[model samples]
Target: MQTIANTTSDFIRVSSEIGTLRRLLIHSPDRGLGKVVPSKAQDWLFEDIVNLDMMRRDEYDFYVKLLLYFLDPDKIKGRVANLAPGTDRGFFKPDHPDYFASEKVIDIQCLLSDILADEVIRTKLIAAICGIERTSFKTQQQLTSVDPVELAKILISGSLPDRTMLFAPLPNFIFTRDIGIVINDHILLNKPAKQARTREALLAQYIFFNHSLFADYRDKIIEIPDNEHAFLLPDSDTARDLSRSTLEGGDVMMIGPRHLLIGCSERTTLYAAQQVMRLVFDKGVVDTVTIIKIPKKRDYMHIDTVFTQVKRNVWVLLGTLARTGDEARKQDVMHFFAPKDLSEDLKILQFRKGQEQKPIEIENLEDLLANISRNDLGATEPVTFIYSGNNEFPFGAREQWTDSCNLLALKDGVVVGYDRNDYTAEAFRQAGFDVVTAAEVLDRFERGESSPEAIENTFIMLPSAELSRARGGSHCMSLPLLREGF
Candidate 1:
């Protein structure tokens, strides 16, 4: 709604998982959580009903504090300046105060205010919601009479003037990662699998389109079409039918500059993965896409939930999924291919619907890496995999269910995750990462006792007793916009 000149300077630039984080977009749990009743928790895509007050008091506030400390612009610049001689700290000043403000972190509520600030944006948004045209004077008057700030809150909290209209609160909106993803210099707006989450995606879409910070990147936003509308479209009459495709950001990962890894699991469909690959390639965004098909189950709802990169070539994976055929029980399969590899023959042979496609013939994680290297480069990069719970059985399963492997990388080797997963924390400690609590890091930061340069390969652990009840971790809550390239 905010019409500003598009510029490349405002675009997102994320290419790898371990890059130094610059800007992040997050949504704190709000009144939406109050609507999630015990009788309708599953309908809202929650594993169980949660206590809204406890979630806000014990979980979200602490998580925001940790994120603010790690992403502080001054600290990030200091770290870069320390690492690279002659680097200018002034160059690291972010475009928006929300990104650099140490005392204030930007939340969805703040974003909505920006969206409604512009008269044109407000009118268009209102028209879209009411299924009317912006040209209507009566509608314009009605929109103008409502205070922008109050309207923004009402829209987000789902407190419609007419209570008869069915409105479901977006409880899962706290998990920002599932709404959208930023690839190298581009934004991919996701179409969620559940209807309750569609509004979340729409809000994100509006924010990206109208937000002043993202004005220049408007053309770069790619909207994934909703699959439910497939029946409305005429049959493609082609070999590939992507109409019914669906993609969630939680299942898509940008592992490296030239490569993207997508999960065809419980939430993302194989058709959607193929479509994303084609779109990225056609736009010259990425060179290759690797599809990892994990078993369709709630536990393995997303790839990030089970695996994430910790360093340049090091990763953390769920113990069970990292194993081979006999040990893994056919739960994990890695599918790799390039844009050029897609042909009518290849499509018909590999991606035919309703038939179980042969899994990528790899014995284990090592074999999968070998395959990736063979196709993407001449030699395989040495990869060190630290499994959750040190590959120990019952403990591993237990910790993983609590999001032990769902770590968010702040820099090359530094990451953040749940403190409740003691086994995974112990594993990170044994791996030489300084396992520290969020309180310790925040205290040092507030007291000026430490800087980003003082901490390397450190895992800042946050209290997750209440947050984990939502079935997500740090990776699920934060969506990175910009990060320093490797």
Candidate 2:
């Protein structure tokens, strides 16, 4: 890992969703993404197999450039003008000497490499990974001899330097948010619900515990313990569902210093949600924990896919999924009298730390988010919402599927999103926010026409032609480690 001499403070806390993000964890698209075959795409949580080169050069590189410009301007300010726009990917590669190795924007692969350099950690991690992948002992032995940098790449990409595959690639590792979440200076590691993501959890746990950067906050790391007799549980669906203690970072949000929101979606089980509520409450990390349960379906994989905070009082979401009761069920003349789909119902329950006897029930997503803005963050302005695809028919659902609701806030009113969500961008423009493309923003920054501090209430759009196919947005790509508190 690279160091920043100017970075002195050891900050690692998140109080609000829309705070100015100073540090985050990200993984650039590696060879593993290109290995995701169509046969196992859905099994690995990908909507479709992506054109890896396009995803790297055309789409995700813009995201990296945008983040660097806003968070660590010195690393990319004037240098971008010299590189070939679409073809120069070496600037983003961590191992490449020319790569923008910003300490502020840390990459997980580099952290893995840093830890793997230790002989003991390397042995233990290799054993652990082999145990999980069931690779032959010879394969494990072969990995131990590889250089730390190459080993780290192979571990994540699951491919050797010569393109030999020893095990399945961790394609979903790009979505760093699923591995763990930081809540008020405490890291809450995830217990993933899916089997395909087991390696990701293991790697993240090792990084948090073994990395020098996280050494200061080791005691603050909160890991969800599996349910009693969880190991002995049968393989049947009913049996596993009864005690599966799974929680994903996507379903978690440290919305306020004293408030945490968890969603019980397809990726996060309610068993894990209840466990987190008790855990955070007992730790005194938060006074309140809210569980927002949405339909357990692929379309709404996590709460973030449905809504994310843009500002203290402003939020963007899929209105189709945020409404409740009659409002959610659109009433046309023919379907007015038909039975409502109970599965679409959105449920909310709030648990106070010491007041567990009287849990509060919130009616719907809008009311819950609005309450957080007012009560938790002390926003006095009227809570406003920008809907997916401008809340139009079919477009809302279409855009939401492409992660229109998923956005990462750079500061209070500025966020990063995909350029493909044209209607959502228009909605932001309509709402009096400046919407600019990532390439254009970088150009402006390079020309000294714009700077991060002066940029406010702006939507920094990224090229996402290939990224959208991976079924994640910028929010999913980032794991905020430190942010300015509200």
Candidate 3:
């Protein structure tokens, strides 16, 4: 594995995916992006806001340009040289041995052990045991004596077609951020928060651990404390240990390589975030993590939904109400944004040096957008806002809930996002960004399209509603491995 010294540079560098990133990952919005249409959209907590056809067009252009604009030209071509602008169902095809096997078996443990052992033989071993199991080798000695690659072949040869090990496809993979976390030069393959996203974890692990571009550098993917996989705090009275023992990469953000601001949403509890912080600290991955408490609200799923970083000392805020109440319904949250001076009531919570303070306030999303142009917290910096709904009068609270504010940046000024809200595009233009659409690009993924490496960075992946039904967007679905200008 490649070994590199950790630097103390304040400007966070976004290298290759591993220790020296040569390429990155993303999900182009596809058919899956809108599987939750009609009756299910709202029930799926879609926030009653969307323009499906227009959204596709806008998102396609955004992702295409995002990668094209950020990645190195040579690197982009090398990674996506094989992809087209359409679907590739052949991705699901098994290896030749699996094809010959009569049956297959799902062996999660063996899969984990082989990859973790070391490189060289990891791929061969993974191919071998991907689908078949051995019942004859009952003794530990028999199993241990067999070479991973050989064992895999033997297992495949003995397997039956009906018993073939079925590998689950990554349906939510379009949201690439859920799979890993960028820590300086290294990136950690994170443990996912939901079973639905597990395939993404595996795919990311494969790309990072086995891919030639990243295999050399494995030491820096931040390790968990004491090699523990889970962290749960002991129960306490009154408070009920609101902190969780589990964490998802979706809730993590790097204000800087060493400085982080994380959200403790329902998927990510305070305890879990704290434990992750502890583990990160132990590994010296960051200097601090300001945990932002997110009150339970179906619409305000994650912190990124309400707030996202823009540039140096600046952010784009939704300017909605501070989350409140237990069992708070959408109607209740709507009440907060109903007033004419809704932005004034909306608070901007700042976290730096381990403490959080209210840095500024706005009367509405529009004011917040306008305010980003000036210095609010003692510093003259650029802060931008994208009103979730129409930027004009007659605020549309429902539109904000569809995650109008959630967006992922590929570089300093370029980004990838769903185009459900036109006002958001205008906001970007106002922020001086060159906006693009996802219409044709997304259709390519749905049609299994491939793009030449030169165009690889041009596309960004956005998750469909299959997983979005669970309340997340491409930004929420992805776990970034590299980030610049955080």
Against the reference, the lDDT scores of all candidates come to: 0.68, 0.85, 0.43
The TM-score-based order of candidates, best leading, equals: 2, 1, 3
Using lDDT as the measure, the top candidate is 2
List the candidate numbers ranked by lDDT, top first.
2, 1, 3
Runs of candidate 2 exceeding 4 Å displacement: 1-7, 82-85, 237-240, 324-329, 332-344
**Candidate 3, 122-218: lDDT as tens digits:** 5444443342222333322343455553333223222223433233223344455656666666665566545545444554566566544344466
Candidate 1 residue 239 Cα shift, in angstroms, is: 20
> Taking the tens digit of each residue's C-alpha lDDT, what string does model 1 give over 1-486?
112222446437888777888777777776667667778888888877777666665556556656666666453332322112122222211223433333223566667766787788887776665442123556446656676666665566665455321356777887888888999988998878776676676678788887877777788888765466667777772123445677888898876777787887678887788778767877878865677777666877888888887777567877666552233322221122222211111111122122224423344544554444344333345656777776665666678888887888888788889889888888888888889877677667656788665778788887777788889888988888878875
CA RMSD of each candidate after superposition: 9.0, 2.5, 10.3
Candidate 1 Cα outliers beyond 4 Å, as residue runs: 1-11, 73-105, 130-144, 160-166, 226-229, 232-243, 324-363, 369-382
Q: Name every residue pair that clashes in candidate 1.
A: 7-216
Top candidate (TM-score): 2
Query: What TM-score do all the candidates reach, one by one?
Result: 0.78, 0.95, 0.56
**Per-residue lDDT for 280 in model 1?**
82
Cα lDDT for residue 121, model 2?
Answer: 97
What lDDT tens digits, residue by residue, belong to model 2 across residues 1-486? 453222455568888888889899999999999889889888887878998888888778888888888788887776775334567644466887778988888889988998888999999999999999999999999999999889999999889988888888888888999899999989999988888889999999999998878878899999997788777767785354677888888899999989999999887888888888888888889999998988877888999999999999999998766663344334421154225543256888898988887989987778988999999999999998898888765577789989899999999999999988989989999988999988787788878898888888899888888899988888999999988898
